[model samples]
Target: MIELAVIALRGVQYALISLTFGLPAFVLLNRPHLDERALQGLRAQVGWATGAMVVVVPIAILAQTALMAGSWSGALDPQALLVVVTGMGLGVALALRWVAALAEGLLFAFRLKGRGFWFPAVLLGLVSVVTLAWTGHGAATECVGKFIHQGSTAVHAAAAAFWIGALAAFLWLAFRPIEPGSEEEARAAAMLTGFAGSGTVAVAILVATGLVNTAFLVGPSRVLQLPQSLYGGLLILKLGLFVLMLALAALHRFQLAPQMAARSAHALTHLRRSLLVEFVCGGLILALVALLGTLSPPMAM
Candidate 1:
């Protein structure tokens, strides 16, 4: 029960942090040529997410400390706190998260626009996601293996944030009433088309990195026996959800995206629903990852 609570908290923290960086990063890269209203809406979305991360990061740190110490009281003990903060990889990752959270807070408070804000926010957000690699299975390895695993994991995580987080921002944009044949509608179509192209590339990266990470973590011999272990079972579930998300994404890219260019309401509605489903699947995958991080893989055992 305690572990479950920790996993749930970690899952939420991970998701929120991903969004905190992902949203701003998307705006920086895509810059979809949106109108004043759409641009303001996107900015507001990012601001709110960043502000929320400022709160969530501290709570996640406390929860992680307690989890590592084996009890809430122990988490507060100076010796336990010292060991966790100084000795553990997760501790370092948490510290990095704090730095990212502070940067995010500054971005939210000042609301800096133009290149000034974009450059710093993008850098901070990328660092936040990349630093998270230290908290996972990759950090447990040795020597050259450690570097390879961590690098791949970091790329995998960044790609996921780009795809899933952007989907969430796009869904929010879709909710606004877009009149048929208006400039706003055309911009929306263009943005959707642009995202679809980028999303395909991101998904390809995700698959390649996923394969690499899986090779490092689990060998071919353990493939058939995965369902017998808790970690492997959860991994299988995550993979299944990932496949479903890919199918939805394909539908969006091939069918819905083209129709959106024509300002088809049906396509827009279906795409919105698909994005929501994909976002939920991404959340579930993160939760499984949180649990998996706390367990020993079958191959390792």
Candidate 2:
């Protein structure tokens, strides 16, 4: 039960982390050009949503650290407190910047052509990369070869962001309402397809790097045995959810999306439901991630 709970928590943590990074990218990519009202509407929605995340994510971090660190006596352990506070501060700031970059990307994408789009897009991209790199760099526990470790870790983090972000973006755009004879719908559909195609390379990087990192942390023998262990079991559960998400993505990308693009309402409805299911499952997977981060892996124990 403890193992299960830990796994659940880790899943949530990772999922939230993924969401924190990915939501902005998703928002930015889907921003509508040629429509000022739609762009403004998206900006407003993102602003409120990002603001809420900023507030909640830190609280969640504190709650999580307190839980992980267990009881504190009269005087808090300064190092523990510092670590927790700094980590949370860094993460929250990065997350906020990520959202900002996304919003900026949308603004640039819609309003500016050529160089204007390139500048904001480049700025946002660099910020996202740096923030993610920092998050990844923080994962290494040892000081030996810290730079090398951090660099590898950054690659891993970026890969996960790309995969998770692509999946999230695909889910978001594919499910939204599509009206027949509406240019908005057609453009959205085109964007969905284009984005999905672009995301495929990111997905590949995510999977490959993830495997490498997992291999480094857990040897092949233990990796095979992970499902029997507490942390392993939870990891497996998250993997299952990921697979389900992928399946839904495939359905939408290959089957439903094209059908909807062809003006099939029935296909569009199915795509929406499928994407919603994937999103729910993604949430569950994230909860498990939160738990996983708190648990001791078999090797560590």
Candidate 3:
């Protein structure tokens, strides 16, 4: 039961952190091409996501404390909190995440604009995701191996944030009441189309990094034991969900997107449904990831 709570908290933390960075970066990248109303919508999403992170991050930290100490009561212990905030790797990472979350709150509160504000805000968000590497397996290694693993994991996390977080953003756009054949609909379609190229690239990176991380966590010898182990089973489930997400993404790129671009009737409705399914799938993947983080891989044993 405690483990389940940890997994749930971790999943929410990952999702919210991903969105905190992903939404702002998406808006920054596409703001020029988006209509005024669309840009405003994106900004609103960013604010909401950032605000959410403010509340989620501290709770996640406390959950992590409990998980590490093996009891809920440990979460309130000053020494445990001090260790989490000051210890190497994960401890430092958690402290950094807290600082980043606070920074985001300040940005959201003031409605800071211009390059100065946005540039720093986006950087902080990216840092928050990258620092997550320290909380996982990457931090267990030493010297050069640690550096290589942490670097790859950071890239993997960033790419994932870009892909999955943008899906959430796109899902928001799909719900807007843009009439078929209208300028707003056309702009929305173009945005989705543009995302296809970047999304594909992100997926490719995710796949490659996934393979690398798998090699580190579950070597070739453990592959045969996958079905026999809980960690391996969950890993397989995650991969299956990832493949499903890929299929849905392909449909979006080749089928629904094209129809929407052509202003076909019912295209928007179909696309919206597909986006919602994809978002749900993404959430499942994150949940699996949270669970996996708590279990020992077959190879590690």
Candidate 4:
């Protein structure tokens, strides 16, 4: 029950942090393609997310402390909290993450005169993602293995964040009713079309890094027996969702994108709905990841 509560608290953890990183990347990469309205909207959303993350990080640490102490009351113990903050890997990482979050929030709030402060925001965002690598299974490995494992994890996460960010941006752009031939519609199509090359690169990185991550977590000997364990089942479920997302992405690129280019009447509507579904799948993947991170792998058992 206690663990379940922790899992519930962390359900959106990945998505939340990823957005703080991905939103900046999206805004910067596609800034020219976006109108002032879209750019401001993204900046506002990311600012809020960064600020929210400052609060969420503490709550997450407290919840985690409770899980460690086996009760909510122990999480409040000052000595216990100090011990956690002092620890090198996870604790220190969390501290750095919080600082980055704070810095980002402050930068976003202040806003530079002509251009926004996205340059620093993007760098801090990368820092935040790197710190997260310390909190996962990759951090458990030793020596050279630790470097490889954590490195792959960080890249995988960054790629995933970028892909997810693009999907989110597309959804937001298309959510409102778009004029069939307005600049907004063209902008929307351009954003979708522009993502094709980057999306393919992201997929390649995600696939390669994903395989690398899975190998470290579930060794070859344990592969044959994965079907019998809860971890295995959940992993399979995650993989299925990923494949589904790929297929949906293909639909977007080939079918919907073409319709959008041709100025089909319902292109925006259809793309919006499909992006929503794909977004949901991405959410599910993150949730499953939150749960999976807590579970002991079959290889370990």
Candidate 5:
């Protein structure tokens, strides 16, 4: 049970790292502050996220092994090690892609000011996809089967990023307070709304593609029987979290967002409160994801 929890925590824990790293990245990208101080701050933010990924994954693997065994020695085989490394590597790549996207968005925002821009976001996105494919190929298949599985996993991963990743960003912005009655506040809100719309579209794609990938990864019969197994229980937990995220998203989109757009102080307050709640739930959901990753599949049981 402890091992399961640890496994589940791994992904969720690291997911937070990306969010922590990304929120500021978004801010830096969307509204470029040319000041040396701002640049230094952004660099530090990126560094912290990168540092965490470098330091934490190995510890997580060791901790997981130790949880399963009395000691970490000989607890994991080469294949398991490969899987862990690949998973973490993919995560790092994905995080970079998100950062890059934020950069690209910033570039577009810059274009409004007559600056010629390059495709940093598009380039980083492609890199992210490539890394994901490289990591997934090991699990999906070794040859042509590798490409098929890689493509499927990439689709699934992108969906996950759209929904889960974006949720993390929204939560961050929500929890952090914006100054009252300021021009920067309005600009911030506009920037946030643009991304919010992007997130919405991403979520839609994620859901549609996630369903397809789920079908391929786990047969319908196994999926149906998932509730009976440990994996199933964790997956159910993840699903519940996902549903909660959806509900919160709706509130943000239909309810609070309009109020905020109108600059209604009351609506802004409500949006902040709701965002805080969603952040907490998102954190919990991430922990469950980490546990789910560690469990054996329902079919395996």
Candidate 6:
């Protein structure tokens, strides 16, 4: 169905945009912690993500157009598509998102991070990520609470992207950490360990903002009835996956990271497995997020 296509495209859009934002932001925050090789590797990932955004953004726009027009054929209708792209607030947001994504691609192609282009690239990526809030409940709240809901959604998304995107970077690094048992390996392990503080901060922000967003969507009174509603059920599933990710993150912080720091046998091996599983969970979360956006909350009903 056209609806399913929109959700699927939106998931891919979110995943790509989040990586385009998250990877560079993560490296910038942990620049000193990562050496040139690790930085180079992650930067390559950023470029790839940005490039994909250039293609994916437009496709997502068209899909939204189809949803708005109420048919697949309507997605290609010039007039209807134009209205969605040029007349509506969704259009404005998508235009900005696409432009920001394109700017990132151009910057990366011209050599990001070295020629004074990295900052602009980061800003563009942030724009692309935050603009996504406009398409969902983030920007749909009524007066008096509109800004609060939007802010919560934006911060929730950014924080989630940062955490999830960094995990992807870590997975890439885990698979090819330059060399094993060398200084590179130790520094890499240290980088992973160093993420504890910032990662915790990101998680804390996610929880707080998530609570705020949930209250606005589901209302506290509807909490007990959540299981009986489609939106609520999906939210519970998303929360379950989130908790699993948290549990894995905790294990990495308290157990595996220490073991890696001490050079225990196969510590890195254990880490690679955990990172893969965690990142997979993150991907599933994004998919659920896409689906959730299409369903009305119990409060709305």
Give the number of the best model, judged by lDDT. Answer: 6
**Clashing residue pairs, backbone N/CA/C < 3 A, model 5:** 7-290, 8-290, 8-291, 9-290, 9-291
lDDT of 5 by residue, 80-135 (tens): 55544455654454445445445544544554221232124324434444444443
Models ranked on lDDT: 6, 4, 3, 1, 2, 5
Answer with 1 or 4, whichever has the higher TM-score: 4
Per-residue accuracy of model 1 over 1-301 as CA lDDT, tens digit each: 5577767767876786667667777777667566668767877776776777677766666677788777777667777776776788787777777778788678657868766776677677788788779988899878898899999999998988777677777777777887655666666667766777678889899999998888888877788888998888999999999999989877776787778778776776787788888888988998888888889876578
lDDT of 4 at 108: 56
Task: Report how far off residue 99 is in candidate 3 (Å).
Answer: 0.7
lDDT of 4 at 130: 87
Task: Give the alpha carbon lDDT tens digit for every residue of 123-238 in model 3.
Answer: 88898999879888888757887888888888999998888878887898888888887777777777877888788889999998998888788888778889898988899999
Q: RMSD per prediction, one decimal?
A: 1.8, 5.6, 1.7, 1.5, 6.8, 1.5
Candidate with more favorable, higher lDDT: 2 or 6? 6
What's the TM-score of every candidate structure?
0.93, 0.70, 0.94, 0.95, 0.66, 0.95
| Cα TM-score of candidate 1 | 0.93
Better of 1 and 3 by TM-score: 3
For candidate 4, write residues 1-301 as lDDT tens digits.
Answer: 6788778656666787778888778777788788777877877777777878898888877877777788999999987787787864777777888899998887856765224577777888889888778988888878898999999999998998878877777777788667886778777777777778888999999999998988888987788788899999999999999999999999988888778877888888888889999999999998998899889887568
Error of 3 at 131 (Å): 1.4
**Weakest 10 consecutive residues of candidate 2 by summed lDDT:** 1-10
What 10-residue stretch in candidate 1 is worst by lDDT? Answer: 179-188
Instruction: Quote the positional error of residue 223 for candidate 5 in Å.
Output: 4.0
